[model samples]
Target: MKNKEPWYATTADGVPLVAAVPLVDAQEEEEEIPVLVVPPVTTSEVVAFAAAAETTDHPQPSAPTLEESFQQQLSLKEVPTSTTRREQKREFKREWRTMKRQAKQEWRQMKRDAKLEARALKREFRSEKRALGRNLSDVKQDLKQEKQMMKDDAKQIKWDAKSKIQEKKRELHHMKRCMRKNMLAGTFCCH
Candidate 1:
């Protein structure tokens, strides 16, 4: 028998090739030869075969684990407003900051208004105090003038009364002197 070249059959879908070994002409071609040894397969071929076998046997769908179910529930409940949850949170924060800033500005404005009102009231009080002070000083000055006039009138009346008393005393003295003289000359000059 002549030795033949090693035959390589093209494999389908990355499957390993299987070559038929030629035997000596003892039995007809229709007879089957029992295979005693398996063909040597590469490591890559074994891995490919394992992967193909694993793919052929479809695994049954198992129930979700606790972590996976929790993750899925979180994902489902995360966004209900069509927007993302992070975006919604950012919007909420921005609105809150705006409200806070507005409130602070309003508070500051209120304080400024209060300060202005207080200053106005203080100015009004000061003006009133000044006016009252002027009025009090005027009244005091008027009272002083009135008191001086009254003192001058009292002094004038006292001086007039003293002069009148002196005149009356002088008149009395003169009349007494005259009567004495007439009595002394009354006997000799009876006419």
Candidate 2:
């Protein structure tokens, strides 16, 4: 992947070859986006389609309720009057659009409030994420260290067996201490 490659969904030509990064302003706010993914078709898709056709069956259900049957009969009423119908349709669409905009605005406001609340919480509990990150990082460091210690040369092992055992035991004890400290930190941070 290129160093400057986008980090989120963009051109869905096989997951964009990578995702796209959110664009940012000077104050570090992320830009929002809407995406639609449509993949291209090929022969494997056709074979899967053929297999599905061979395996699938459509089952018909029996009976309908009295109200359902009546609605089915009655819904095909006299055709709506043209100009009045068109006017009503236009009004309905306008109302629908107005409602949609209002809904989106409300949703955006709510999200902003939620983000504020999260930031406030984070500020109140400063060092939480850093503490968690440190705990996991320490565990990783300890594992790396133990792995390094365990990589023995044959000549060194023959000459220094007791020293190696003592060193290995010390390493194991250090690892156990790291594990315990990490567990405590994790529980405290979570709570």
Candidate 3:
């Protein structure tokens, strides 16, 4: 045997590159194990090599986690038989029916609420219209009362002026009659 020692690869920074175990122990095994003497490469050379070797199309896959492995194994092992598939289909149908029923009930409730709101709005509108009508009528009544009062005042003023004119005409007639009597008597006794 030429060499019986274990081989490993490392960088210049004393960091081990490969951590693989040797297939045969150096002390017990007598077979010759060829040591792969790797040249010491710098970190920059390793980075450049990795960059040159990397491809954009094919990406390396990461190792699966324990939970992910367990789920994958379960999925592979638990193949759905015909009976199990039928049961799943029935369960899905039941769930779909319940969902559809819930949706229909919710839709009907929404429609009912909308109708009630519309009715309430209509009632409010009608009441507002009635109130506006009552207010308009009250305004019209007030205007009529004011017009009647103005007409009555005008009539009273006209009657008072007519009475004054009548009294003035009667005074004028009596004065004329007195003047005529004095003139006829031709005496101071008319005083």
Candidate 3 Cα deviation (angstroms), residue 8: 69
TM-score of each: 0.53, 0.24, 0.48
Task: Report the C-alpha lDDT of model 2 over 1-191, residue by residue, as the tens digit.
Answer: 22333335446465443333334432343344333334456799799999999889868797999998889778776565547877989989999999999999999999999999999998867778888889999999999987777765555676598788889999888878777877978743211
Candidate 2 TM-score to native? 0.24
User: How many steric clashes does model 1 contain?
Assistant: 0
Cα lDDT tens digits for candidate 3, 18-117: 6545556566757665454455668999898888877446766999999999999999999676568779899899999999999999999999999999
How far out, in Å, is residue 81 in model 1? Answer: 4.0
lDDT of 3 at 18: 62
Please give the CA lDDT of all the candidate structures: 0.79, 0.72, 0.82
Ordered from best to worst lDDT, the candidate numbers read 3, 1, 2
The list of candidate 1 runs beyond 4 A from truth reads 1-83, 187-191
- TM-score winner among the candidates? 1
Off by over 4 Å in 2: 1-83, 127-191
- Lowest lDDT sum, 10 consecutive residues, model 1, at 29-38
**Model 1, TM vs. native:** 0.53
Instruction: Give me the displacement of residue 18 in model 2, in angstroms.
Output: 93
